[model samples]
Target: MQRYFIAPEQFGQHTVTITGEDAHHLLKVMRMKAGDEIMVCDGLGRSVLARLTSLEAKSAEADIIAEMETNGEPMWKVTVAQSLPKGDKLETVIQKCTEIGAAAFVPFQSERSIVQYDGKKEEKRQQRWAKIAKEAAEQAHRSIIPEVSQVMSWKQLLLRMAEFDLVLFCYEKEGAAEGSGIADVLAAFRNTHDSSREAAILLVVGPEGGFTVHEADEALAGGARLAGLGPRILRTETAAMVGLTCLMYESKEMGGA
Candidate 1:
């Protein structure tokens, strides 16, 4: 069945209104009629099995039949703090990470980062990323679209790192040299989290040039664990995806049982 995400404001009583692009897609593209069955998400982990109540060219209403909690979300809230990479890599990173269950994304500027974010570029980039995340979330059957935060400086990044209960950095230089691999770090984190308790994990990935020794040291000192993704070096976007995959598998798949 096709699924659509609606804001909390769109939901009320026993029905929900899907407007804007969603209405057009359902009416024009999907050709769904008033009696057609569809799934609607509240973008807050609630999925409702809804039956179309009315349909028009630009708007549609659906009567929610049954409401259920989304169980696909990972037990741990994984946030990815990625340094802005060059070109369109950031979009790919955001889309794939959202599909893989990243709860939020923070694009930060680091010393070696090639793409500098001034006011104008940052706003444009965030808007673009938000659209990408929304589409990806729908495609991946996710209930909520991960938020793309405003651009932050390296100093601001450190300050936000304090919020997470656990943070892991895929420092290719350090983790590859040392014996601590990503899998090991994930295992350790998984052991610490109890299924009955709420926990959050933050993973930081640097851009093409990767995090410098000085930046890595600062992160390590600020409580982010340095871990390796494996022997082969991965691109900035690839590193984030791999780290998130490992984390989701461990924390959600295995930890749940």
Candidate 2:
């Protein structure tokens, strides 16, 4: 069965409505007709098995047969704070991390970051990143679509740190240091996880040359724990994916292995 992510408002009693691009895909591209079975998901973690019943020029309606279980959401929520890397690297980061169960992606400014954005470009880039996340989520069968936030300044990143239960700064300089290893931090989280409460984590990754010493100091002062990926260094795009992969693998609901 084919799958489509529909807006929450479109899901009504006994029937599901699909419009816009998705509808066009079904109507023309996929050529789906009445009686076709399709899996539909509301971005808010609700999925249903629906059968196509009617279609207009660019919209399709389906009858809700049964609601499907939403098991694609991770037990732990992770927000990846990525310093904007050069070229289309940010797209790769958002796509891969979304598939890895990252709840959101935040692009920020860093001392060593080479790429810069402003005005129209910034808005357009964010939109592109969002679209990438949506496609990735649909492909991964995720219940929730990860968000891609606007680029933030250093001050903004600091302010956002307080909102999360845990903040991990992917510091390459954190070598064999106490409380600075990713494994140590993850172990602590796994051991202390109380099912009753939700865990919101922020994973910060630096750009090409990585964070300057001053940035590292500021992050620490702002409540971020420096954590190393491993002995070998990873690129700006690769770091966040590693962080998300580890988080997903350790969480019970996200196919922990």
Candidate 3:
């Protein structure tokens, strides 16, 4: 069945209202009629099997049948803080990371970032990134869409590090002796936090040129732990996805008993 995410307010005691683009997609694109069944999610981790009760040109309604058990969310909330890369790499990062179970995405400017931030096009770019995340989430069958934050400056990103319980700064220079292994860091974090509560983690990935020595020092000073993805160097767009996949596998979100 096709899945649609509706606002919590749109859901009543036993029915859900679909409007806007979603309604158009259902009525016109999907050609869904009354009594057709589909899956509905509140985008707040709640999902239900719903049957179409009414259909209109610009709106639709569905009756909730049964609640669904969705385990698509990861135990840890991993936020990808990626420095802007060239072209549409950021879009690829957001889309892939969302599918890999990233809780949110943060685009920031770094010292080595090839692509400069454009404030005039911020709103348009953010909207595009957000749409990518939503579509990826829907395709991945995620209960909630990952959030895409406004592009931040290096200073802003440093300050924002305080909000996370753990921040893994992906530095290319980080080697076996100097850098912390991802598995070890995550294991320690899991041991410290309560199993029942989701832990907030910030995975920082630099741009195409990667982070400068000064920037890495500043990140360490800002409470981020230097971590290496592996021996091989990864591109800016690939780093977030690899980091998130490691996290999900470590947390057994990928599959475990």
Candidate 4:
């Protein structure tokens, strides 16, 4: 069934109203008419089976049949802190990672980052990424839309990592012989996971040029384990997706999916 993400407010008393661009898409693009059935998600993990009751130029209203439980959200919350890359890599990462169950995307400026976002540029990028995440959530049938935060500095990113139960940094500089690899990290979590303990995973990926030695050291010192994504070097965007996908699979295997 087709799904659309709506604001929590749009979910009124037994009715789901879609306005703005979504209304246009349903009325004009999708050519949906009255009595057509569709799924509506509140973008907060609440979904509903709804049928179109009225279609107007400014809005579309649907009568909600039932509230679907929040079953799609993964048991583990995975946040991706990716260093700003060049071109449209950020957009791609946001869309793909959302589909893969990333809870949030944090764009940070690293020491080796090539792209710099200051002031207005940062705000514009955040807006674009958020839009991509929302569309991706709808496409993937996700109940919650992963957020794309404003670009921050490496230090700021590190501070934010403190909020998560486990912070993992994908260090390209980490050799294969490194004591703790990505697999090892996953194993450790799986072996020690507790339902009573609210745990969250934070994956950090560097830019195309990768992180500077000092940056990697800082992350490690800040309590993030430096794990290798194998010996092969991955591009900035690719590494982020890799880390997130692995987290989802591992979380699922550990009953956190």
**Per-model C-alpha lDDT, please?**
0.87, 0.86, 0.89, 0.86
Identify the candidate with maximal lDDT.
3
Q: Give the TM-score of candidate 4.
A: 0.95
Q: Which digits, one per residue and each the tens of the lDDT, describe model 1 over residues 1-257? A: 89898898889789989998899999999988989999898777888999999988777888889987687677789999999999899899999999898899999999999887789676777789988988889898998889999988999999888899888988887556656898787778767767677678889999899989999899999999999988898989999999999888777554556
Q: Per-residue lDDT tens digits of candidate 3, residues 51-151? A: 99999878999999999999889889999999999999999999999999999998999988888888899999988998898888888899998889888
Write the residue-wise lDDT of candidate 4 on 119-187 in tens digits: 867667777888899999988888999988878899899888778888999987664865667888878
Off by over 4 Å in 1: 252-257
For model 2, where is the 10-residue window of minimal lDDT? 248-257
What's the residue-level lDDT of 254 in candidate 1?
47
Clashing pairs in 4: none
Report the lDDT of model 2 for residue 154.
80
Better of 1 and 2 by lDDT: 1
User: Which residue pairs clash within candidate 1?
Assistant: none
What is candidate 4's local distance difference test score?
0.86
Residue 65 lDDT in candidate 3: 98
Error of 3 at 117 (Å): 1.8
Return the clash pairs for model 2, or none: none
